[model samples]
Target: MNFLADLLDLILPEHCAGCGLAPVLLCDACALPLQGPARPARTAPEGLPPPWTVTTYEGPLRAILAAYKEHGRTALAAPLGEALATAVKAALTPHHLPTTREAHRGHDPPSLVWVPSRRLATRRRGHDALRGLVDVAAQRLRTTGVPVICVDALRQRGRVADQAALTARERTTNLAGALDVTSPTQIAGRPVVLVDDVVTTGASLAEAARSLRKAGADLLGTATIAATPRHHPA
Candidate 1:
């Protein structure tokens, strides 16, 4: 597969998802925004875990994510997953720096439960992009001694329409009762951080959180790569 990919890359040189630079999946200049401090998502829904995001869903970050998700540019997952890992680390224990004792003693961190995208969408896309992001992020986190585990705990209960055209309220309505916890035994009494690639109205995350809580998991907030920025009252 590596040989095939390399041959394909040489034949059809890949352009940076952010800039048009050749051979790089995402360039450093475009990655600067992704490395910026994680911030609260703008339009969080009630019952949604407190959200942490790396950047706004605009410009190069948006383009990169769209290319990875919509266009099946799976090679971009490494850079994008690194960004998500940074956000997860920032949100994990904001004030308390990890002690050398804890780091060396091998304290287990909470599980990261990724909210699976809609089944229909994943079927059409031929891959689960969010799951890929979670897998890579978990690997990076473990390398940093975070002891994170990735689990696919939630499943879509039914088909739902695309949320791009829906209002925030409509999104909430559409996602209500739309997620189910697949393994209560695995999640029960476990601390979990919900993860997603992008957050718009946060309806999907909220629904996933509800399912987790119902199944006895301790919900510990959320981390995402980007969020749709919200307007504040002047």
Candidate 2:
């Protein structure tokens, strides 16, 4: 299947999502923003884990993500996933070295838990966009010897309204109690990093963290490809 996909790519080369350059999913100029010095998100919700992002959700980066996520441009996953891997690395670097040493002593590395999109949204889109991104990111991390594992431990428990027009508080209210851990055992005692494609109001990630912690997961932090450029009150 992977070979077939590669063959198709060769037969019908794709243009960069950020720019119209052919033969690449994303060009170097557009990818620069994604290769970033990740920092804690400015608009993180209360009680949410420290959130890190590669870039602000705007410009070519925003357009590329929206295309990949909303328009079925799955080919963009390759470059976007690589960018996500970089963000994850930046988030984990300070503690990853010590964790690596512990792994040599037989301790398992941290587990990655992707915060899935709402069920209705996935159904509407006919695919779980976040899952594909998570898979690709995990694969990239493993290739670099990160000693990480991807775990699908979260699911939505109720419907959430479209958040695009919702205020920050409304977004939080809408997501409250909407997410739950599906397998507590898989997450129990594991150092977990929550993954998402984008962070806007931070409501969804905060709700997810609450559920994981309730299930006994050691929530380390969160990582995202991009974040909205709003000045969140500290």
lDDT, candidate 2, equals 0.81
- Candidate that scores best on TM-score: 1
lDDT by residue (tens digit), candidate 1, 47-146: 7756888888888887788778767789888888887898787778753434435746764457899888877778877799989998898898888767
TM-score of 1: 0.86
lDDT at position 45, candidate 2: 74
Q: Residue-pair clashes per candidate, as listed?
A: 0, 0
lDDT of 2 by residue, 1-234 (tens): 245644664577687778757557778898888776778778787788668887888888877887677666887888778778877877777674434456679886878899878777788666888888888888898777787788999988877798899998998899889999998999998888898988988888898999999999988888998888875499
lDDT against the true structure, per candidate, is 0.82, 0.81
After superposition, candidate 1 runs with Cα above 4 Å error: 1-11, 21-23, 94-108, 232-234
lDDT accuracy of residue 91 in candidate 2: 72
